[model samples]
Target: MELQQMRYVVAVAETANFTRAAERCHVVQSALSHQIARLERELGARLFDRTSRRVHLTPAGEAFLPAARQALEAAERARAEVAAAAGEIRGRLAIGAIPTVSSVDLPRLLVNYRTRYPRVHISLRSAISEEMIEQVKEGTLDVAVLGLPPAGRVVGLRGHELARGGLVAIVAPGHRLADAGEVALAELADEEFVDFPTGTGARVQSDDAFEAAGVRREVAFEVNAIEFMTRFVRHGLGVGMVPTAFADELAGVRVLRITDATARVEVLVWSRSRPSPPAAALLELFDIDPESYS
Candidate 1:
């Protein structure tokens, strides 16, 4: 079937209605229906089952959905490759990061990259670690910064370790431990905690740090947003785990290094493949080595 026909089929499959699908594809309903009918004739199988009131994918259509999506993606990628080979770095690059880094790191990095490559359009999306990884794999994101362990995963991508520093305890500026520069994780065993949401990179790191140090954290709050955690920590809700950069910036919060040697987190740069020149240029601005930032 022709690419146009496949596009029609995909649109119809997604919307499950001819009129809405046509609107999405910027075509008339009659034209879209005709294209799908032609495609079905060529394949000798009906792709969808439609009645007066309902429309749904047939078994064959369900099976073909993924393959059709891949074909479209491959076609788009081929066009992008040609555009890049022509020495024109002028396509949208979608980059994602976890919330903490997005706030602390990306603003400067993006500004510098834009200055250097003004022709290259850039879009930044922020999410927790799990969401970012999925977006990368699904091609919604060109690259992402996440906190997955460096094992038991495919390696078509490259990862750069940017910064390595231990987790620190953060509290309101006037709290008892606020004046301390170094504190053990276990020392706050009875303290209330503001924690990262479940299934996030920061949460995972926080859990690992406590487990390694043989400390059981009593979490009074488990939140999905870093901003909430920051606000709560500032109001003396409890201690929280935050990136070193974030801890340094929050005006009314005090950060104390974890005395336990095992409590550490590393900032990483990751991409599904070797990044485009624009992304690579942006990544270069980060100080992966702790000594450089220090």
Candidate 2:
């Protein structure tokens, strides 16, 4: 029932180990377990099912977790809002981005944000566009930078375009199309490709382009990282399709323009609800009106 008890429960649920949760909460194991037991007794339900090897949330714990998180978030926001009104911005800012983000220099931007709001705590994570979008919607992420094919849309969320460009092809020096200035999708239909996993936003651009042009290509190498994809192309494992800026950075691969390539759109997205003070400040740095989204 108490906030401290809820904190212990949430931490235990996240770590799935009483000892680890106690360490994370800066308390002893016995104390955290005792508090959680008190909470469970007060609620007339057991929140967790503990075994000798592992711990997991019981049905009651699953129902209690979301409300506990909301309560904690609300308390933190209240404190942050009061601080902001007193001319000091203090809060947590959780940002998510695709690994291949290039429209903005994230490191530089975050440094500037830190300089401007020294009291705010910031966390950044890299994930595929779809996962980031879902995190933003779930309120786990305050903002995100994501890329999608031109035909893709950001449904159920608020976002604005940052940049749009077509993907370029890369081939090894010894490949048959290495000397080509430009090639169409059909020309590369028979060539094996090194690309991101099938449903990722990075792979969708090339996939849509091939489908639109009625070309079917084999993805011989599937990788999650752009650097790995480029490396595969450099070793003649397969051809790759990557952003122009990324392609220009590689040394051993020959970059080729795709005549029928689809464009990738980079977008900055956030929840449709009003943003936290820290998130609003970050959005303002981008010259975006946060109130518009609200």
Candidate 3:
């Protein structure tokens, strides 16, 4: 029932090897095994089904894992809260962002936050907007920078709009529409497109626009990365649409104004409850009131 025992179990479950779990917990294998055995005896349920080759969580372990993680996080947050009361901010800050985030200079912001709070641990990950938003809601991510269609809304979380702008069409220099200064969605409907995967927040703006305009376009290349989309357009694989701010960064492609394009909105979002102290500080840097979210 000790927190240390729970930690050992979690480590074992995550690494799936007693030896590696012991290494991660900074204990000898025998000691780690003995602790887990004692814990199992106390609970009267084996947590792991262990073999020489692999370790798998037992049904009981699977049930206990979530509570164990929550307990650990609660304990850590308790300590962080105490430190924050004493004017010291020390906690883990997990941040997520879309790959095409352009509203804020993320690297510079991270650098500034790090300089101001050297004791805080920080991690950043790149994901699609939908995934990042879900992580934020799940408490796995403290904050996120997300891009969605202008009409999209953030439910069950607090979000602040950072920037909004229309998408620009990109084409290869030799393409028929390359020289066109502006084109409508219907005009591009007959052209093949290179775009983000279907249903991604990045792709939805264009999708909604085309649908609203009653135009059906062919996505010849479904790419997960913006660079790849631009590359496909550059090589004449297909035309593509990107945020107006991001379009200038892509080389070897012609940027065209979309006369009837949907706008992309970049937003900063955090959990309405349980944002860590470091997350609060970062939000303060952006002049956002975290308490309002709560």
Alpha-carbon runs more than 4 Å astray in model 3: none
- Top candidate (lDDT): 2
Clashing pairs in 1: 162-288
On residues 163-221, what C-alpha lDDT tens digit does candidate 1 reach at each position?
A: 45556678898889888888887788889899988767778778777777888888889
Off by over 4 Å in 2: none
Q: Pick the candidate with the highest TM-score.
A: 2
What range of 10 consecutive residues in model 3 has the weakest lDDT sum? 285-294
What are the clashing pairs of model 2? none
Worst window of 10 by summed lDDT in candidate 1: 285-294
- Residue-level lDDT tens digits of model 2 in 1-294: 788988998899999999999999999999999999989899999999999999999999999999999998888889888998898889999999998898999999999999999999999999999999999999989999999998788898999899998889999999999999899888998899999998999988888889899989999988998888878988999999988767668888899999888788999999898888998899999999977664
Cα lDDT tens digits for candidate 3, 1-294: 899999999999999999999999999999999999999999999999988899999999999998998898888799899999999999899999998888899999999999999999999999898998889887888999998888898899999999998889999999988888888888897899898888889889889999988999899889888898887888888999888898779999999998888778999999888578999999999999877664
> Each model's C-alpha lDDT?
0.72, 0.91, 0.90
